[model samples]
Each structure stands twice: as C-alpha cells, then as structure tokens.
Target chain A: MKLIENWFSERYSDNLQLSFRVSDQLLSVKTDFQRIDVFETYDFGKLLSIDGTVQLTEKDEFVYHDMITRMPFYYADKIPEKALIIGGGDGGAAGELLKLGLKSIINVEIDGQVVEVCRKHFPKLTASFNDPKVKLIVDDGIKYARNTKEKFDIIIVDSTDPVGPAEDLFNEEFYSNVSRILNDGGVVVTQSGSPFYQPRGIELANKGMRKSFPHVASYVAFIPTYPSGFWSFTMAKKSQIKLRTENVEKGEYFNLEIAKSSFALPEFAKKLTL
Target chain B: MKLIENWFSERYSDNLQLSFRVSDQLLSVKTDFQRIDVFETYDFGKLLSIDGTVQLTEKDEFVYHDMITRMPFYYADKIPEKALIIGGGDGGAAGELLKLGLKSIINVEIDGQVVEVCRKHFPKLTASFNDPKVKLIVDDGIKYARNTKEKFDIIIVDSTDPVGPAEDLFNEEFYSNVSRILNDGGVVVTQSGSPFYQPRGIELANKGMRKSFPHVASYVAFIPTYPSGFWSFTMAKKSQIKLRTENVEKGEYFNLEIAKSSFALPEFAKKLTL
Candidate 1:
C-alpha cells in the first residue's frame, strides 16, 4: 500500500497507530513547553493534539471528561464546592466541574499554548473558561501545589502521560503536596494510563497515590481515540467511597451504573499493578 | 506522514483506520467464502484478518471469547450440558466452553479456511478444537439452526459484523430459528457491533431478539483491536436474568465483577438502541 494523503496518525505504542482521515490541518505550533497541533478530521470532527499525541477529540471528549471528574465527585460524601485541576489545558476536567455548579475551580496548567489553541478551536471544552468560577492559571501544578496555602475539597490531575513535562505530577513528592493542599475529607483523582498497554504507568501512579492517602482505588473507561480504548484513573481519599446512587444530570457517557461498573477491573487489570 | 514499512491497516470506518506494524505476512489466502490474511506484528503478536477486517489477535482474544460465552452461561439456570457456537471459526468461543465440564459442543462455521488458518497460526484459541467433546461443522449457521433437531442449553452467535457473509444471521427469521432450537430456559448471546459506531446494528439485533425472548439486554466490553474500543453484545433469555453473584472459576479477562459490570451501559450506550 502507498500513502497518497496526509493522515493524522498518533503512534499509541511501539506496534499500534490510530489514524484519522484529515480534512485539514488547522494549526501547528511548537511552544516553549511542548508541540501543539489541531486538525479537522472527517469523522472525529475537530481534534487537538499535543506533542504528537491526541489530547481530545470533539466527538468523544465527554467520555474522558465525565469519567475523570464525575467518578471522584460521585465518591465524595458531599458535593464539592472548591476544586483544583492540574494540567487540563484542554479544559475538559474543569468544564465538567463547572457543570456541577462548583463554587470555584482553579485550573493550573503549565502549557498556555494548549489553552490558547483550545480556546480558539474547541469551544465545547474552553467555554467553561469564561465562567466566573473557573480561574485558568499558567503555572507548574507541582510548584503551585507546593507554594499555595489554599485548600480544596477536590483535586483533579488531568496531566498527560507520565513523561516529559507532566512527569513530575506522578511522583510521591507532588502527591504529598497535593495531600497538604486538600481540606479534611478531600478527594483527589489522577489520570493513570491504560492498564492493558501501559501497566507500568498505572503501577507507578498507584504506588505514588498509596503513599499519601489511606484509601486508593483505580477505575477503567473506554475512550476510542486513546490507545487500547481502555483508560484508567487512580484516586485517593481519606474515607471509604461508595457508589453514587442518586440520579443526576447525565452526559453522553456517565451515569450511576457506569460509575460503579468503572471500578470493576478485569482479572488481567487487577493483576497489572500488583 | 510517510510510510516506510509494510503496515497492516484495517479501515475501521470510512474515516478511521487501525494500523499495526507488520513484521511479516505469514499467510494470505482467498478462500471460497472470504479472504484470510495472517500477519506477525510487533506488539499484538499474530493477527488474523477475514475479509479485510480483524478477526482475532493472539493477545486480546480472551476478552472477546470469555465475555461472549461466560455471560450467557452465568445467566443460565442450570449447568449447561450441551452448547452450540455459530460462526466462531477461530475456535475461541468453543475453546472457552471446552474449559467447562460441558457434555458436548457443536461449532458451525461457514468457512473452513478460518479454522485451518487459526489452528495453524493461533494455537491458544484453536487448542480446544481438539477436545473430545467439541465437534467442528462446516456449514452456514442459519441453515444448521433450521435443519438440526438437536437442542442446546446455550447458543452463542459469535459472528462478525452483520455484513457480507454474516448478514443473514442478524435477521428476525434467524433469531426465530435460534429460539426454536433452544431448550426451555436456554440462553443466547450474539455480537452486536460497537454501540457508538454501529448503533443501527445494535438496534436491529435488539429488535430481532426482543421478538423471540421475553428478556433482552445489551452489554459492553472493551476490545482495542475492534473498530471502536467499545463492543456490544445482545442477549436474550426466557426468564429474568439476574446478575451472577456466586464465585466461579475465573479467566484472565472474565470474573464475577466484570461479568456484572459489563451490563452497566453508559448513558450514550443506553440511548443507542432505545
């Protein structure tokens, strides 16, 4: 086979590549922090790529946003009022929090270019930035966590894979700072890579989270554009978390049944971290 | 991007393609029914393609085979003595059933080349075909269901996407024949395509199954090699199917927790076929 077209391919792993038919490459920029590229695809609609990796697609951003934010929210005993998001430059995690009527959400993102690109191209995610409660700050999340005296009821780390610019977010020192910055009974959730393809990432994150919190659990969700379509999240809190049984406003993906089911790991996944 | 090597690409949809880095093309045969191609890949091990679509891979076949066979078996009231598999020429579903102490199993495959190919290239999936209780029959599943007077306690329709050679298996008449050949309290499960990508297929299969059985439900499983990471299955039973809570022998991908969790559909999936 010969290549006659410009295809946007994300090399998910050494052997796997997920490619979308590109109608146009909307923007390409090499920021001081990382490379950012945005494209208009035929099926996935608009796509935002950071450092040759898919950040989020217009079609299925809800799956990632809903699972990462709402799962922690569902486990928390009380509805969160003040929250903090780390490295979600695409604004997905913050956007989900804004919908839940959080009083204040401080999104500390290191890459201003990612936020700028998403604001210009992806409205569904960046629209929350205009809300009064969401404060977008361009700073290192680890530095912010270490320096700030402010406390939060919920802390969400939406960083990229545990490599390059986002690598520090997965270490024990950062998690200890995150623990310091949270109020009593506060909860924290971080994106753990796919348990199937990236077991080492999940294990490292789980090991780091277990250092600071008494209770820690991991969950899985399906995001098609992601590698292996199986994504995991590691969460830690002071108290035991129960499934949210109440009926709330639902999105394209999340619900109470899925909330509980997301934590049910397969035997293969359960053995990954151990 | 430029392609410098031989890449085995499966066009999942009109606008998306899943490609694997191909190290070698082991076999390529144009059988009487469909094209069968096998390749050795970098990460996914050996790959099997039928009619240009992925049939199974050495790494993740357990996820698909275990969910399809185990779920129905879990719901059946009694221990299944006899079982029948339709269109699973790779011997995956039969392989799972053979693990149980079932009395007998008959696998009806439309194409013999798939069995021959899988038996040679993918031993993990085809090893159960040699079991004394397992019988392989080369014939159309619909014709076999219509002609055979023998009834089964469990019937598994492990066909491909409801197109081309497997098109007839999705119709109402075929489901009616399946209901006829099942014993009282018998359970049936079929692969409905990804609810996100192929809603029409899920809807049609759900509609057909609703015609024959009193209880019908759809569940999801994640298989990265599929078009979408999320895949759906439609199951119908004579009585209310309760979640299996008892401890049972577990597989790498299937356990009581995953068996119950698989039925919890996301909101988008809930609306896909409804």
Candidate 2:
C-alpha cells in the first residue's frame, strides 16, 4: 500500500466535513466526466470518491448496495429476470442484481474511469461485473433509457447526486422515459439523498416519480458513509407496490421484514414526502 | 455569534473524525463529572458535546429525544405517570417526558453543569425542565436507580456512552435495579449506541437488558449528530412488549407507525441483537 500522512476530508456541506486518516493513496484519475480517487484508510478499509464527494466506503457499501437492489425485488409480483442499472459505475448495484439470478443486466455507466478504478481497488464491489449475466455499457443513462427499445422488469437508477451528469436523471422527463421502457408491473428505484440534509432532493425525486407513475413512495436505509446517514430511495411502480416475494435471499441489511418496514417514515421524513 | 476560523472536530475512531464549522463557542465548563462544551454550529444550529463526544445538535436533537421518550410509552399498558430519567442532563429527555402529560418525572443527572449549560444554550431541548411535572435531581444515575424508594412507570436511561461515569449503567446490575423499581408492565429504555460503528455496544446493552427482564429487544432511530447517525435503543420489560398506548404525542421522528416499524431492524442489526 502506498503511504501518505495527509488526511482526506470530504466536505459534506458548507458547515460539515468528514475526515479520514489515510494510510495510502491507491489511485487518482481525472476523466472528462469527473475526478475519481481511491484511498486506503486506516479504519474504513477502502474509500472511493468522485469530484471530491464520497461515493462509497468499503465499510458501508454493502448497506447501500443491499438496499438499492433488494428492496424493489421484494415488492415485485413476479421474479425479476432482466434489470437495467443506470450510472452504477462502482458495480456495487450490479453485483447485488446478480444475486437475484437475473438473466441479464444492462449497466449503463457514464464514467468509465470510475468503473475501471473501482474494479482495481474495490474488488468486493465489482465482484459480479465479470459475471456473464451483467452487460456493462458506457453511455449516458438518460439517453439510453429514452432510446432503448428493450423493456426491463426492473430499472434501477443508481446515479450520483442531482448534479452534473446525474442531474438530468432526476427529472420528470427521465422518469417518463423510465416508465416507457418498463414492463408491465415493473418498478423503478432511485437513490434520493438524505432527508435530514437534502429534504428538497427527496421532494424533487418524489414529485418526479409521482408525475410518471400512479404509485410512488420513498424508502429509507441508514448508510453511515452518506451525508446524515439517513439515506432514502424513491420507488415508482405502475401499481401500488406491496411485498410479494418471500425470503429469496438473506442479506446483512435487507430482509423480508425490513423490506416492508423500511417504507415507514418518521414524521419529518413524512413531511418531505408531502 | 463569536466567530472562529478553527473547526471543532470529534474523533469518532482512531481514523475517523467529524468536523463542524462553528459560529460561536457558547459555553465550556469542566464539571466535576464531565467536560461540557456547547457551540453554535453553522449548519446544525446548536451543538452539545460531553467528554469530547457529540451528545446532540439542534437540527437532529428532536429525533433522539422523540424516539427515546415516545418509544417506551407505546409499550406501556397505561399512560406513563411517574417517569424517571437518568443521565439526561441536557434536558432533552425531560422535555419529551413532559409532552406525555406525565403526573410526575424525576430527572436524576450526575452532572449539573451539563444541565445548567444546556438550559442556557439550548432552550429548545430544555424547554420543559421547569414544568411542574419534572423534578430535577443532581446525583449519580446508577446509585439513584438502585436506591430510590419510589417505583416508576417508566425508567429512561439516557446516559452517555459506556465509559467513565456512565460505564456502570451498561451493566446487568444496573438493569436489575431498574427492574426492581419498575411498576408492572413498565419498560426500561436505554440509549444503545449505533449498530453500524458500535455493534458490540448494542449487543452488550441487549445482553444486560435480557439478563434482568424476560422480554428485551432493541429498536433503531436515525440521529444524524450521533456516531453513525443510525442509533439504537434497548428496551426491557417484565412481559412481552407491544403497541398498548396510542397517539400519546406526535413528534418530528416518533409516531405510532415508527414505533412499530423501528423494532423491525435491518438484518445486520438483528444479528447484533442475536
């Protein structure tokens, strides 16, 4: 491991910054899209950042990956066979989809550098990228979702924050395209930021989701690496979503009970949905 | 506001630190028991730290207070009248207890400095301390619980982490004393640490609670100022605990739905309790 003495800090907001004592800088690359940096930290194991924002940490990536991939599957009436992942360059979401035994997954990632670097540094996150079921595609997710003739049983917009390249993906038009490309009874799940720190972000995602689907709701999963740790995911379905699948898999964070319970929001979170 | 260029950072672990930009240092007191420092933060409003650990921030204090006081009330067969609060020197728990319209509340705090400082700095948290229902007692919480002659309908252990003066509160002996002084169908709720970063802390709390009461379980509430933002509370009772009281109070984080759902832990959290 390459060693360094300087600490790596991510400014979560104008007032809050989270600092990690780094043991080594594993890789740094500046692509046309965004800057990617991977570091080996003393306590959190590995860290990934894009444009100075923490994308995932090895210690807590499983919590995000498990919730994003497994929560929607539990609500589906039929077993999911095909999934389309948008902007999950880290491959964490793709790896989780592979666990569902899906026949195929079209992972559209805009930043190839993110995937290439994470593949080298975070093997655990990219473990299933080499699986035959996952088809990695380097393209703009909104464009692909709009133009693709193929319909997906499940569509996961595992994009970054609503800024830069991922900004378009958080709009009504993108959600409308997502609705068009989804099979009957298909569900779309997108990571909405923390309600505590970014309540407006969740409100925007909820408004966009409601515009495209009859049934829309936000679910919460606590991720320590993310801002506020109280992260949310907005789910939109053609029909009202309910738990239909039983224990298809046992995970460290997601289970049948959690799938149903995660949707129950605290009063402040409920206000954001309103 | 007394502006400072320097940041106030709390070291979460050997390698992790959370820093906040401060507008002013409102109070800094080295009490005989613990060091209490209150600051006006740029984003989180007011922040309170004890022994160099963040106890609460104005932006998220309601989430912690609402969950701690309201969760156990749902498990009680009757409206909690005589409630006991230990180590909630900040007065956040006492404020919440007053909302229940309790007949009497005995708040035993070891550190008077924490209470006096917070009362002056954080009026929102300490608003109800002067209410006729609350009785503030300055003493050791463990000794107070063990030696009190009066029985309580609810006993809330809102102590600090399992260290220094608060270490004895995490043991089975303290929980046994809590059981002895509780009315029938009473509940003992203690602030278990975050399940993400401090799983062992929660496990130990659960073990101790189980040793004293037949029905013991842990619930979760996301408090952004805490270590992982994902915090847990361990509850023990003489018998099975379920939804008995309804609509006692509405809060920013606590509700009937949240009370029922918070008990449904993520798979990893469930493993911690196991």
Q: TM-score of every model?
A: 0.96, 0.96
Where does candidate 2 chain B have its weakest 10-residue lDDT segment? B242-251
Model 1 local distance difference test score: 0.87
Per-residue lDDT tens digits for candidate 1, residues B93-112, read 99888887778999999999
* DockQ, candidate 2, vs. native dimer: 0.85
* Model 1 interface RMSD, one decimal: 1.1
lDDT of 2 by residue, A1-274 (tens): 7554668998988889888999888888889998888889888888998888888988888888999999877776688889999989889998888877788999999988888887888877787789988999998998998899999989999988888888888899999999999987778999999998888778989998888899998999999878888999999999779877656576888887788789889998898987
TM-score of the A-chain for all models: 0.96, 0.96
Candidate 1: segments with Cα more than 4 A from true spot: A1-4, B1-4
lDDT of 1 by residue, A1-274 (tens): 6655679999987678999999889999999988899999989889989899888999988899998888878777777799999999888888889888889999999989889999899877889899888999999999999999899988999988998988888889998999898876778999998888888778878888888888888888999898888899988887786755675667779887888888888899888656
Per-residue lDDT of candidate 2, residues B170-217 (tens digit) = 889998899999998888899999888888778989988888889998
Q: Which residue pairs of candidate 1 clash? A: none
Alpha carbon deviation, residue A105, candidate 1 (Å): 0.9
